[model samples]
Target chain A: MTLVGLAARNVLRNKFRAALTVAGVAVAIITFLLLRTVLWAWTAAADYAAKDRVVTRHKVTFIMTLPLSYAQSVRSLPQVKASTFCNWFGGKDPKHDKEFFGSLACDTETGFTVYDDMVVPPDVLDQWKHDAQGAIVGDVIAKKMNWKVGDRVTLQTGIYPKEGDWEFRISGIYQAKSKAVDRSTFIFHWKYLNDNLPANRKDQIGWIVSRVHDPSQAAGVGVAIDKVFDEKEIQTLSQDERAFNASFLASISAVLTAINIISVVILVIMALVLGNTIAMGVRERTNEYGVLKALGFSNKHVVMFIVVEAIVIGVAGGLLGLAIGYPFIEGGLGRFLEENMGSFFPYFKIDPRMSVLAMFLAVALAAAASVIPAISAARLKTVDALKRIA
Target chain B: MDTATEKAPASHRDKAEALVSLRGIVKIYERGGEQLKILDGLDLEIAKGSYEALMGPSGSGKSTLLNLIAGLDRPTAGSIDIGGKRIDQLNESQLARWRADTIGFIFQSYNLMPVLTAVENVELPLLLTKVPSSERRQRAQTALRVVGLEDRMDHFPRQLSGGQEQRVAIARAIVNDPALIVADEPTGDLDRKSADDILGILEQLNRELGKTIVMVTHDPAAAERAKVIRRLDKGQLK
Candidate 1:
């Protein structure tokens, strides 16, 4: 038999211990994969955010509203191709109050033009425009709430208390064409909400989204738009959509950093487990190494044997981790999170690079961890080593 | 006294056609701030194709002598020339290569790798050489056959009795056809029948194959089978 084959056989010398070590490494890899996926899914919105679109919001906070006249000024910019304004409606379906989804009152005419990723039939858009009370829900939310085009639904909002519940008919359902577009939003005309609102809250918009003619000039166009309202009663902060999404991420950067650190910590823990096992194996086989040296094997051969054994264990554990992780994360948890937490994780599938990295780290770290023990074993004095029984 | 001298003793051929020779060998070990001399200024010569036994009481340095002659260790002072090469002057890496090419070792505990089968254990030494795979396997099988263990080639060490394990260890020792074989208490752990069986194999390996054998044993009965028996007391041969 070849030396490598002989070395690999040593891994099975203690079958139960080897199995447990493999399982420990697999568990660590699974944990690492899950943490990495969480970080990837959290920042997915920013990663896929439209490059050519700019968002204008209140300078202080998103909770404050800008005057509706700001939308006309933003649309008139030389770089602006189209613009739309929307306010967070904070509406909840009375039938399913436990479920969460985005609800916005947007300019129906320009909303479909600026956010072209939301694909609706031309007839449905026409129908929604004619009927002021018509509301279009995303396909994901429509399936969840069991609403159809002709069905009428009622919503309740604590922010805008009216004499009675707000009523609307489902005019259409829109499908998302891009990963950045959430598939669970419910949109209705902003004029209907303004018409019913008191005079103090009327004629106000939450934010404006503008699409630029040239994506390279979108940032410059945003600065020019914000300049127009710098001296107005309420100033605006403008940024490209990616930067706007990144601002939201900046608020929770600490949490993301923690996940990243924990992922590396799991790898370190795997190395420790592997190192301990290799050390113990080398200790028990100390006499065997002496025997090998006595039989004309060199110190390098002894070291190679130990390292090859560790690599075999690493390969077994890495394969097992991927076997369990792919189905658990990509198939089950990913679908659930995408449907339930669409705003934060629109696309929750594992990145191919994450899987490759996890496997590579498992093998590399296992090999690296064995270096100390292997060297120690190889460095033992042959005469002294043979004196001991172990 | 020159540790770096690679010259062989000039009177070696005049000393009974010696294949192994030692001149003024001294080995000292320090323990707890005390100097313990395991072997004093000792000199020895073993002829080619001779079966010799080294018998000594406990702490008499018989095993230490065996280690020096086998090239597993160097003398603290003086020279050890085996097969006309000054092994004491060789560095660790060169000694390892020399050991693979010249000396074969059989230990008391039958130190065969448990993970390998009998034939694979026998093939271990040849792995260090340029021997091709097919020839290595053929030579290992031949060695096992020479030791009358052809039927047990596929068995692991755990499956074999103490006698059979010692036989496999013997096969491994002789598989490389080394010029010198050094065995230390080779049958110490076996029963009377197994010990006799191992002794028979050693005698056959020496008389039939013309192999030079140097054995260290406490048993007088085992030493009687050798062509020459030397006793050691206080690190000096008598």
Candidate 2:
């Protein structure tokens, strides 16, 4: 008998239409969340990147490398506290030919030091540094490949095309401490790649990474590093880690932007679905509205009732979407994205804000959807409504 | 003879002093650039708790006049005073507020919200008032009990018979305890048995509860039950 109870009951007047409207809203919210998740994960790398770390890449192309001696000049900068380099190994496991993971050649000792967020066990780091032909893999990658700590694995180099299969002993496994770090990379000593390289590729580093003494001076250090090699035959583009991650993200900018737009479109569609359902219900209940008016209900009261009904339906749909979306994403999509695109998305979970916003949007859109119908229903002439056959 | 010609509820005459007075009320409807006059300077008055029937042919403006008295429609040009206050001058929102406080309405078709149970439908009018929901439900139940529908209070409209539905509608009308009750063809869609039952309920409400009943109906049997019957032709009472 309460207004809220009556409003809630009114949503079930046409069970099928109401159910369809709720389903439409649920689908919209789910799609919106999915797309928003994509957009969030795509930019997460840049957002979580370290401001104190600087990256040095070729000014013309990332494919080109800088002289290993460039590390000396980078370390000499007053702002640079620690400096190292990591060359993209571009190595693939011969057994699992299609599974994509990062392979990097890094300074055995200083590489992990500069990027200390990546955690490796003490024994593993010591063992990795001791062996020349040794590599450390991520725990996730090791579990997938089922490689033991001491297993000898051979990987084929796609870029270099080694004369024979490049073999390495699995010296250790590392784990990521944050979402920003990829959990499927294989990092080996730079000396291992450099010692076996041809003369043309010898003593060259893919990109120099530096940790700054102060985050405020990071931009200055980056400028100084680029300036040091700006006039040389090989120029450098030095930036903080965030900008370095952004360049790679720029490759899939179109997909990310499209997803953003589609997320908005789903919300718009949800609004439309809500509006249509409310309009239809109001039209069907015109006579009932007229009866209410005759019984002394103010126009405001009538409108409130209609809007409350719409909002009740909206809440139902929002709760339904939340109930379904969480399990669908975490159980189904999360595992798929984590296993397949670990580099881009370490975890595919819905943001708390997205769920909160969905609830807000549901209520807001429901009220908005009822605006026209409520107004028109409230405007019904009492006599005219009475005269209605129904 | 009384100054108002004694057209008042017989039992409540002292309190029934011409609650609704309409002088020269006219209503014109414009449809697609064509103007149609529904009411033409109709003048009438009814005292409180009067059980009066308005009988007329189609397009006779009986419903229009009732709508004006109930503050549900505006007069094209006239003065309408209900309960000693001029109501025709009120805006739509003001009229709505006034109607909620003073008027109860019943229709030929039981225009109950089908989604609501009979008690919920009865409780609807109290939403316009300041009554709390629990009190509203109690009042609605009392109203349904008065109409002998207490047992059916929890049933939806579809589950009730035509007469029961009409009784539920009447319960809803009186739930607000409004001074005036306006019924437009209250039993127009009912069968003989249902119509008789509805008519009996209205009679009881008028005689026992002293509710003001102003009904517009073409049914002679329904008109006969009214204490006073007014005939309308060409938008004028005759």
Docking class of 2: medium
B1-238 per-residue lDDT for model 2 (tens digits): 2322234445656555797889988899999999889888888878776888988899888878888888888888989998888998888788878887888888777788888889988888787677886898899999999999979988989999888999998998888888889998989989999899899999999889888889999998888888778888888788
- Write one digit per residue (lDDT tens) for candidate 1, span A1-390: 788998999999999999999998899988899889989888878888899999999999987999999999999988999999999999998888988888999998999998898999999999999999999988888887899998999999987889999999999999988877888899999999999999999999999999999999989998999899989989999999999989999999999999999999999999999999999999999999988887778889999999999999998999899999999988899888877887777778788899899999999999999999999998998887788687
* CA displacement after TM-score superposition, residue B57 of candidate 2 (Å): 1.2
Each candidate: RMSD: 3.9, 2.5
Share of native interface contacts recovered by each model = 0.61, 0.91
CA deviation > 4 Å runs, candidate 2: A387-390, B1-16
Q: lDDT per residue, candidate 2, A277-310, as tens digits?
A: 8988888777777777777666787798899998
Q: Which numbered prediction scores highest in lDDT against the true structure?
A: 1
* Top-scoring candidate (TM-score): 2
| Alpha carbon RMSD to native, model 2 | 2.5
DockQ scores for all the models shown?
0.66, 0.73
lDDT of each: 0.90, 0.84
